[model samples]
Target: MILIIAKALVKDESLELFKREALELVKNSRGEDGCIEYSVYEDQEKSSVMTFVEKWEDRAAIEKHEGTEFFKEKIGRLISYSENIEITLNSEVL
Candidate 1:
């Protein structure tokens, strides 16, 4: 299995727009093949910060997700509102 943890510090004025785009991305991604889980959350302490916790069946599925139009369009728009973004990928040890 593959896991992805992503965080973004969004512009204060752009938070709502970012949330809309992100939610659409999450909703669509959850229905894709091999998508084990996909979720987005807001940071309690920082209204401008958002995070994504994701799990996929494998690297190939992750790759496929990256190539999807939904990702290309929505993710691109979402990042435009962020001052900084970080992503980490991991595989289950077991």
Candidate 2:
């Protein structure tokens, strides 16, 4: 399995727009073939920070997800709103 954690720090003025697009991305990604789980959360302490936590069947599954139109149209817009972004990937140690 593959696990991913992504964090985005959105500009204050762009929060509403970012949330709208992100919601659409999450709703669609959860329905993908190899998506075991997918979710996005806003940090109460840091209002402009949003985190995405995902679990996929494997690396290939994640790669396919990255190529989807939802990724291009919705997630792609998020970069413009974010001041900074970070991502972490993990798998069980063999």
RMSD of each: 0.7, 1.2
Candidate 2 lDDT over 13-93, as tens digits, reads 999999999888889999998999999999999989999999999989999999987798777799999999999999978
Estimate every model's Cα lDDT from 0 to 1.
Answer: 0.94, 0.93
Q: Which lDDT tens digits does candidate 1 get at residues 1-94?
A: 8999999999999999999999999999999999999999999998898999999999899999999887999989988999999999998898
Instruction: Tell me the TM-score of each prediction against the true structure.
Output: 0.97, 0.94
After best superposition, candidate 2 residue 45: deviation in angstroms?
0.4
